[model samples]
Target: MSPTTRASRRRRPAAVTIHDVAARAGVSVATVSRVLNRKTPVREETSRQVLEVARSLRYVPNVAARSLSIRRSHTIGIVLPEVHGDFFSEVIRGIDLAARRAGYHILVSGSHSDRNEMLEVLAAMRGRVDGLIVMSPDVALSALHDQLADQLPLVLLNSVAEGHTAITIDNYGGAHAMMRHLGTLGHSRIAFIKGPDRNADASERLRGYRHAMRQIGGRAADLEVPGEFSEESGYAAAGSILARHERPTAIFAANDAMAVGVLSAVAAQGLNVPADMAVVGFDDIPIARYLAPPLTTVKVDIAELGRRSFEAVIDRIDRGLPDQPRHECIPTSLVVRQSCGAATSLRRTKKASGKKKTTRQEEI
Candidate 1:
């Protein structure tokens, strides 16, 4: 070969085809396709040889063409409000695990809490996916019903939509329990840092905090602080609480992300956790355990929630059962840690009270 021939050959795209793989493996293209699709079992040795040859040739199958032939994409679409945090990351990991086990791929898109963006993402996925796992807290159920009406199978995660399969956490119960626990620990002056106002989970948590506050004989309206489920919002809420003439002895953020912010704010004020102030949060994200005081929080199995959501959507898609029950609630549990100082502070309070009573009795 001459220099000119070598240059032309280098520029040419060496595309590998299934027919080439089949020929190299001494099999028909149909046999190769069947082996790849698992449509029918092939002899073990023959299947191994075919796969080996395909890998040697660096052959890639056309999923689009396969979908055209089979009328199924074998892809699941995941739509989320945001995709930056540990919560969403864990959910995606679980979804990926289940999807791969079911021999399906995932197409993930984040709308960043924008309704129009979510609609656009859904529209783009119209004919490209077999089912969807949607986690849109700000989007309305009416819009979802109108837009996706009988179009594609969908499972809602952390959302409430009528007539759709959903997997959600026990936000209200978890928050209520945390508040009641704080009360039992002598934290009557507790403040709540809320999530986004439009979020369903945030609303439920806020309601829980208020109800629990009333049970403890505290005024809910005065202690509530607004947050957007972001660290910045939590920091801002903490600052607002600190600026008050009377600061709360403890603060509970709606989520772990915001609770982290509260920690930063408290540190900035040169205050110590549980001594100067106590802190607690929901969603025991990985960092919660590693924090300086090891934050107290409500634990929701976020990854499990995602796995169940994908399984539910897959069932709806494969079984074609519209009458199946569509709603599920994942439970949450309280995890007590040093951040709230429920154990140490309560002991100290009781000890100090006992000492005071003893001193008064001796004087009498």
Candidate 2:
């Protein structure tokens, strides 16, 4: 309870290991190893006793030794931008579930959205992990190019950097599709809250928006606002757009978080969604469906993205990058809902192009 006691508790010895189990069971180290690895069948009662002793001591097998024996870590290292968003968490959950089924554990690292930290994470994972998975990285692609492709089997998720196995949604197609959907609903003067400038995914999304606006036969200049993929930034940026006396009838945010913020900001000004100022977001995070008048956003198959990315890295690690399968592409689509000038029609969500999902690629 006291400060000294708390500090001492924090400095306690690390968790008990296999040797502790062996010593407690009065057995040789090899016996303990064989028991855990099931290399040979020990007498049932003896195996029970050893397991009981290990349990009592909270003894855990060493991952390193097991990996060395199998020539595989049965573990993968995943580096993420940050843990704050649903997008990252959902992908991680999918990866974790698939990895667990495949008899692997995930060692995760957070780069905290910094370039140096990304490098540090990559360096830190070099030898200790079997494969690597990184998302919308903050590091320069050039720095990761040579080493990432050869040194380790790497998967790039939600970001497209060359020389690594990549699993990403159709960023350009999704954005372009969503914008066209808005135009279909009679929203012409649309504004955008762009995602981060340097991030590859964000850049791809913004490019799609610009390209779509051009397709609508306009210059598309000054159609975007400087905004990060956060609700706070979206809300704050809304103020400037509203104050400029040049309000657009619809707004598109690069991701759902910013879209939610835009909705909140507009509502605060006594405006409405779709009716007054329509909103569309990308990457349909969970909250998108639950909002008042569910958000009409682009649905990216987040789980498949994670699973494919994780599997790609493992495949590249176990068997050198295969030529047959280079990159796994996840599809995205405009989910029409009440928020984007569509009638309060949840049934019409899957289609904005007035077509149904006919291919497995489109569904994914």
Candidate 3:
């Protein structure tokens, strides 16, 4: 060929293929395939040589072809109620990290906590993922099972569905513990800002509060106010609670967002937190610790929950679905801070009685 013709051919770079990599590495195509897929073990030195040659040649594997051959997409689908706010972000972060470590990708979608929307998203994900992680607290388990008839590997996050693996936070235990802490600090007749009625987590937390109240011989029905698990709703609920003929000395919000709203509402009313009206919340989001009087809240490791859910679904994908479903509930703990007035309550008790009583030191 003429020099000019050769230069033109070089300018039109052709896509490098596995064949080129194998040829340059002086290995059979099967050896190169085994090394690249990592499905079957190969000699370490040979594997390194194949990888180095592929990198040097800028050879890329055809993921679509490989997925077709293996009958796996090597991707996980995550369907969450809503992908907004710190909680969801943390969960996504955890899943993404785990997925990357396992050489898998993730597809995320939001269902807006609506059954129809969730079904639609699940339908769209068919054949596009190897497994799924779903978080639909408001939907019925029966409805979900009916729609997922394909028996695709699934992991439920913060949800419950029989015959499927699930990873959920201990919403009831967390709320109950918080209530006990408040009661220890002498906070009876505490007002509760409840989340949406249909949400599972919200219902569990409310149940915990009610059970604890009954245990202490306190009335719960009268001091409860409805909220949407939002800051604005918490603010509105707090305002209504404060205007009551018999105001509560403490308010417990369902989540950190609402707790922030309660704090703002309390300040707007010229009330000091913990001193005038103690405040506490569930789900210790990142910002909770940085709040002015740092929030007292239930600590749920949101990211760890995500990581575990990812691991569970991947496990199902590798080893087909188990005959018996696995149900895992992550525990929660109380993180006491300035907002709950535990320290203040202790100080008052000591001064009034002229005797120092031992109490757990407050958590920063």
Best by lDDT: 3
Deviation in Å, model 3, residue 278 alpha carbon:
0.8
Model 2: clashing residue pairs?
none
Local accuracy of candidate 3 as per-residue lDDT tens digits, 197-251: 9899999999999999999888999988999999999999999999998889999
Cα-lDDT of candidate 3: 0.86
**What is residue 265's positional error in candidate 1, in angstroms?**
2.3
Better of 2 and 3 by TM-score: 3
Instruction: Decide which is better by lDDT, 1 or 3.
Output: 3
TM-score, predicted candidate 3 vs. hidden true structure: 0.88
- What residue pairs clash in candidate 3, if any at all? none
Ranked by TM-score, top first = 3, 1, 2
lDDT of each: 0.83, 0.76, 0.86
lDDT for model 1, please. Answer: 0.83
Q: Give the range of the ten consecutive residues with the poorest summed lDDT in model 1.
A: 355-364
Task: Return the lDDT, model 1, position 113.
Answer: 78
Each prediction's TM-score versus the true structure:
0.83, 0.79, 0.88
